[model samples]
Target: MKLKRLQKMSSFLHVVLKILSVSSVVIAIIVFFMKLFNSKNIIMNKLESDTIFYFQTEFFAIPDNQQYIQTEQWILVGVAIFTCILIAWLLWIASLIFKDLSTGFTPFSEIEINRLRKIAGLLLIYALAPQILYSVLHTILIPGYSFTFGLNMSFFFAIIFYCLTEIFRYGALLQKESDETL
Candidate 1:
């Protein structure tokens, strides 16, 4: 009965994750195009209103007067869209894992273990890639723009997932042994 409940919950979660993943993609695309076409007009209006819209960094602020700020802002938008897509991809992977669980596969099964590892790897990439790219591009493209790189919670989660993968591997081995002895 407990297993059935778990399976039902996993199925529900799987569906939810899949929906969220698709939605993220759609939203990212919409945002990207909006930024692409409307950014100049929006920035110009904000500037006229004296809204003091500037791209501020830890070290310095590039005000709207800078010729390259718009280009930099566009690049930032692209990065944000890329990150959103990456998140969507991660959600899709998680949905697949949940789908496996809903199909009555044990957590210790090979498929789950592999999927967990993939999630871990992707998490690590997700954690590091954006920061590295942001730091590099900003420092290089924008004068006097310096960004400090740091690890975030997703990195820790990646480590935890990797540990979980090993635990699941051990459990699978033990399960195999128990089944053989039965």
Candidate 2:
């Protein structure tokens, strides 16, 4: 029957959607961990170079024999794993937020939704600013990378990412309505 065919189609679509969602989540986590590792490497390298300079020049009084390796490779690895998990959790939370917003999406709303919408808008602006700047400067600087700009780019990405979290929050409201109808 047409009903059974439609059910089969719906089930297939649902599975496909779940696969896409899980893949996106995994990729995002991988990206976060990669960024964490790279950042820690940069920090450790800078510190090592500075320690070497101090030993040679400022601390000529003392022998340049001490190894001042403050950061361990293991620490960076652990941090990367932790950060990736945190990002994944935030993604789940954002979905909840979006679900909530979806429930309140009637064009004519006189409640706190407007305030929340404004808040979301402001956050989007904040998140996009650095990305915009990074693109402009990267185009100009072509070869050289800006440390400050890099940090801003990462921060901006994080913000915009969690912003979608509201999707889950808003969507929950609609889910409730659908459940009640059943």
TM-score of 2: 0.28
* Candidate 1 residue lDDT tens string, 1-182: 99999999999999999999999899889877887788865331111122122232444445553777786676677667777888899899999989988999878888788888988998998877765676677777766565545556777898999998999999999999998999
lDDT computed for candidate 1: 0.77
- TM-score per candidate, chains pooled: 0.82, 0.28
What are the per-residue Cα lDDT tens digits for candidate 2 across 7-116?
55555554554455466568656655565667544432212221211221122222542332222233333334444444444444344334433443432232334434
Determine which window of 10 residues in candidate 1 has minimal summed lDDT: 44-53
Best by TM-score: 1
